[model samples]
Target: MTALAVGCPYPPCTVPTRDLQPIRHSELRMDTHHRGRVLTLRRIAPVVKLTARSWTVTQESSSGGTERLEVILHRSNHGQDILESESMFMVKEPYYTLSDQGDPTLRIDHPSDLVVCTGSLGNDISCPSSGEPGGAVAATAFAAPVTNTAKECKDEGNAALKQRALPRALAKYTNGLQLVAKDTAANGSIACDLHRNRAYVNLLLNRLDEAKADGTASLTGIKDQEHQDLDAKAYFRTGHAAYNLGDFQEAKSLFEEQQRLAPSDRDAIAYLRKTEVRLHEQATGEYDFRKIRAGLSKTAPRADAASFDRNTEVKKSPGRGHGLFATRDMDVGEIVLCEKAFCVVWGHEDEALTVMTYDVRDDMIRGFPAGLCKAIVQKVLNNPSQIEKVMDLYGDYQGIGKHLIMRDSGPVIDTFKVHDIVARNAFGPGPVYSGGPRAEEDVRNASTGLWIRASYLNHSCVSNSKKEYVGDLMVLRAARPIGAGEEITHSYNESGDYDARTAALKTTWGFACTCALCLAEKADGTALRTKRRALELEADAWAEVEHAAKAKRISIVKARCLARSINDTYEDVRYNGLPRTALLRIRKWLTEATTRDLAGC
Candidate 1:
């Protein structure tokens, strides 16, 4: 085989003759016109610089005579000096042959093809029977030949999957699977890829069970690393399905398995832990689903719990619809509803109710409930395996014991959940209230509670109904007449300023302030700013009078006049009803003034 180099104006200036090898017979036969083209040429001797437009090739003919070949050329767009001739010569022999017959007019057109030629003259050259590159031939050889009609279907399916058409991807995968059920090598990869994609689609549609099954199938026949990943995904999807179905134990187990397979998967770990906590709560009877149902059912009559029929009614907002409404006019002190919380999450503080000491029939005092109490105490002390799972889910119960101590010292509790709802509307400790004659009253009211149904009472800066706790029951008594269709609201904060209240509602509850009182408060704020200046002047004047009286310089008449002026300003500015702390300070100052004698001073 022989090889030669041809120069072109493009980069990598010299191209090899016959691509430095022989062209395949099949490839050559397919394009016969391109065969034997002088695709490349090399210099036989060092030559002087020649202009691109005019060049000469010197060759020794068979007769031993030196022949000079001149070719007229023109510059091409690609900067190549092209020959304008009907014939050209071989680089070595200089024998003229057909070169310009189909020579490309544009230099850039298929310049690569023009640069390299393949023929038997080049070393390591061979004619390919198949008209493809070696690697493509190898891949084709590895693939099994289609023996059945199903093979064509499978191929079509694969094409669809590659196109990212999910329905078609699934159809192809199923058809492919049906064609070769036991063949792991030929159809397995295609089937698995299709199933994986289907699982992704199912997940997007929130079909957890279908997603889990598809994920499982996708993992089949996969290698070690890929198999483990597929298994983790399968288990994770299974966990989610179980969680939505309220099978917390099953969900926890599946999630734990997923976490074991992929320890760095934070979402799996977090969700697994949450499921474990829920399971533990269920086992301990800490979460009462029945109570939640009862609460929601009882509140069904109130407008707060009304159900909207989506088929007939056009909803103005996503979750807005009339369901619960008053059936009849009810007076003050009437029973609106009686309901228990869906779930009561007793924070760690409720441990005080564990009954540590027992009053025995004998004179000696022993642990309460001897058996049950001991078990409860032991569970707390030893930290049960179930509790470990809960801890794994929510972290170790840090503030639980502290709450227990506070509960013993008369702390409060709060709880929430709704009935008829697939999931709890809320979940947390119930609120409690403590008050007594003694400054340090160490008696807790465990039975005094607020239920989840009470949560339906919307928030208000000034509420018409007052919430009163009477031993595990919350009574909502009307402080004023409630009109029909008006949302029942309660005060979330007893001591919050207008700004603080607005911020809390917006941040925590995701709502804008549209309440009547809120509007009035906004308007009052502007007026208050002006009144504040006058009130400050009056206060300053009273302070001066007080100082002069203490120094025995001002008369009692003048001091009284200043004090009266301050009081008048207080009433006008609404500071007369200031909080207890400010009121006490003013009273102390007034008492001192009355005690001192300023006769003629």
Candidate 2:
């Protein structure tokens, strides 16, 4: 077996005397010891089994410090080494095993835990030269040793936190936690304080699960009246974690407990309101969209809205990877789903925040839509438990179904993988924009977000549903009655000639739309295309005249006649029940004109 030592050195006595040896099928053993503090194992080896017995030190160091083992698995690809998985184990219980398991690659208990890969790696892949992997590493697992007393470590942690050195503070808090003995009432109270403080740090670090665990742990084994403040904070932190984790009921319960403890706490009061709003949204798909939209900010682009709907489900589509299908019959104009974006970049306020990368090979400009990849990466980094929201969506990345590995520093994430997902799945600034040739252009220039469930609804020219956006919230409504088990689809583009629509879909989504409307247009051949071209020209000429007519500078009667003439062109069975771009424009203008005329009423 081969091993590479990494991380800072510890006192000789703190180092385990025995070596971590490879375990066979039924036997575990310890081998020769290395003087270094950290060990690295390559999966290329037949069986790399690391057990904790050989890694823990028996004698307490002079500083009363301890060391925990963190295992980080990485895979090298495209000259970049990205994290595959990470895990932390206490020194006394560090047993972990990795095997080829018939596939001759990698196999673990939790296959879905691995980060999505951009593509298959070549045989020449190599690890990075640095000892530590970069990006959002957890600080608690390898904290420096501190004095044995819990109070001293807690004080040090508090001081570090005040200085805004989060990672250092986490180390101190973790060290204090290790020294705490929770057997007695006084000691347990001290333990509670340490747990609550540590939970706050974890909450800041975006380690939601750890924060909740610590917060809940702090609430137990103590009932001191003097510690009410600490208990209140613990409840608040746990509630925040649960809320972000989409557990509204638990969050509400936790927040209510905090309120009971700290009646006048304004923060607790604020969270209770947000929790109630989410609860209401979950129960009923109604929302005050205008209020939500007006609430967007640089720090808070999306509200803590509930993404709730039970009418649809995800299932594999024959050609598409997956698609959303109606689980129950839906009536026209009924809400299909109302989903909050996984991440959104608001462009209306910050028009300069866009990132565009031109693909030389593909001969197309791929819009990153305001560097949303960074937002996604930061979101996953903060609350890694929600990574499934980003990873399970469609992307060019082929690496999936791998187990997740966590390191002490944090979960290893590949920005490129996230970038690929964002580029492929992000939707525009808003669903409603100006119509005509400029509509696609308007969508391209607006804000964009990744809505996981909504992405599964495939595209159709004459779609069964229509989607609208309110801030980052996406509301899908049935445009026509849909039957149970019917696949939900919506048009991805504005109304245009068949050639323009097909070309746009092919260039943007890489799929030639084969919807019934397109098939009918295709079967009509050249004569139909010629007639449509003539109508398009006539409409363009009439549009100029209609604008003058609306301004009262031309005869409105001529404009009305021209509009009726265009509407009659689509009266054929071929265009029946399908979107008529020409008629839609005319109807929109007439409706607006009638509304203006009725203002006095």
Winner by TM-score: 2
Candidate 1 local lDDT, 180-284, one digit each (tens): 575645756666655665666555444445666676676664448777787787777767766653557777887888888889999898897677656654443
Minimum summed lDDT over a 10-residue window in model 2 is located at 52-61
Give the TM-score comparing model 2 with the true structure, all chains together: 0.66
Candidate 1, lDDT over the whole model: 0.38
Q: How would you encode candidate 2's per-residue C-alpha lDDT over 1-601 as one tens digit per residue? A: 1122211111111222122221221221232222222222221112232320111111111222222222222222111222222122112112233221221111111111222211112111112212233211221222322334688878988998999767657767776776675434347767788889989988887678889989999985345655777788899999999997778999999999999988999999999999999999988877877677667555555665888778899999988879999989989999999998887765544332343455554666644453355556656766667776677777654343222334433454544456567666778745432211223324334567788898888998888999886656788999999999999998888756877888878766767888878887777686766676577667666655555435442334444665667665554688776766655555555554423332211
**Cα lDDT computed for each candidate against the true fold:** 0.38, 0.59
Q: TM-score for each prediction?
A: 0.25, 0.66
Model 2, which residues run further than 4 Å from truth?
Answer: 1-153, 163-168, 171-191, 260-270, 290-300, 348-354, 358-365, 407-409, 412-417, 431-446, 523-554, 564-573, 591-601
